[model samples]
Target: MTLHEITYTIKDIQGKGKGLFAARDIKRGECILSEAPLVYVTSNLQEALKSIFVLSKKNAKYFYALCNVHHDISFEFGIMKTNSFPLGQGSTDAAIFRVSSRINHSCDPNVHQSWNPKTKKGHVHASKNIKKGDEILKNYIPILQIQEDRKRLLQENFKFDCRCSACTKPSSERDLIITKVNICTGLVKESAESDPATAIQYVREVLGLLDKIGGICKTSYYYDGYQISAMCSDYSLAQEWANLLLESYQIDE
Candidate 1:
């Protein structure tokens, strides 16, 4: 789909100091857009150079087409670097586009993007009830870190400190949530190296911490948020945690 055809409109995010998409209306699980890359470049330096050389000749028509089609070359290149989605089995080449790259990150984002290699397109979807004027967001980095880490990354990459729910929370409550997140991270690490018997102990510890923090600890980005739910075969809990994650985000089972 062309940029203007998409249902969302770009708007200035409060405190984020960047443009973000906002739903024009309450969109269901509808496909907002499916976009193909104007340019596909590999991550490996040598491979990328080689692909560029090859495309310069083999796909020269398309290459010239992109150069003419896109107005801001530098911005397009930056977006490709920042938001290019991976494609090809065992291949490092990434697909870059305009609309998807405009999406800013959030710890609690309302939209998600999915890449489909067969179709050669990335699908953007609403993950929650995005209000008409709510700035549509997708977490750029994995939101599994504590508040400090999350804030640091946002400031460094996006040039603004996050005002997301977790970042703007009261100091006392934020600290407690961080403590629980730390505990859960430790338990997950321990579980990774422990025997089945010891794994259960770690899992129980994580669940206990989750219970203690209540809603504050229940945000989707926590590292071990779905571990207990997955461990106990609690599909309901697992689904809840899955829904919390941004659409394109993945967790090992």
Candidate 2:
């Protein structure tokens, strides 16, 4: 939809504004859409503003559809600030993807978005199975942090309260997950030498927790699995984690 062919269709979500909805049942790790960015800004507020004015009329229409998180700035700047994603982790350039930008945010997002600098294209992949007609989502804030920080960050930037299951989990369950995550990080670290078997189990536990918390974007644990597995000379486990890691990032052959 929206000038590109995707498995999702554009629909107006009542309180959240526009959102992407699955047009069919989408399996986990499936690529929802892949396309070159509509525009690239050198990841600065000033450059983004200038680009908006130069965008062709056709492109401007799509830009206008994006949400304005910062009302204090020019409309164009707000759109860029709110909608643009990084070229890659810690990159200075920002990318605006047409179809993927329409995807709304959920703490427990069903979809994960990744940018490939080589091809200069963005890919949206299903992190979990999405039933037909379900609204597709992407995380606007880092999901790895404690829920409290995640909520504050979302409110500060996106100007919304996150009611996702992760944020609203019962106090006891929330604490347990956070505690497990912290312990597992050390376990994954030690698995490289001290105990590969324990590391695999720890990473699996962490990944399971991540899925329960609706976080599939951070695949570092998969690399944890692959590294530990390979160190232990477990090729089968290493390959399984490698495949999962690639799919999580929407990397294809």
Query: Number of the top candidate by lDDT?
Result: 2
Whole-model alpha-carbon lDDT for candidate 1: 0.56
List candidate 2 stretches off by more than 4 Å: 1-6, 169-171, 190-198, 211-218, 232-237, 247-253
Best by TM-score: 2
lDDT string for model 2 (115-232, tens) is 8778778888787899989999888877666777887899898899887766676646765776678788886786658867877888888988866655554578888888888888
Clashing pairs in 1: none
TM-score per candidate, chains pooled: 0.58, 0.85
The TM-score measured for candidate 1 stands at 0.58
How many backbone overlaps does candidate 1 show?
0
lDDT for each of the candidates?
0.56, 0.78
Over the stretch 124-234, how does candidate 1's per-residue lDDT look in tens digits?
766566676677677766564667777787666545677766567665664675576677657666664344345545555655555544322233333344555566676
Worst 10 residues of 1 by lDDT: 62-71
Q: Cα lDDT of model 2 overall?
A: 0.78
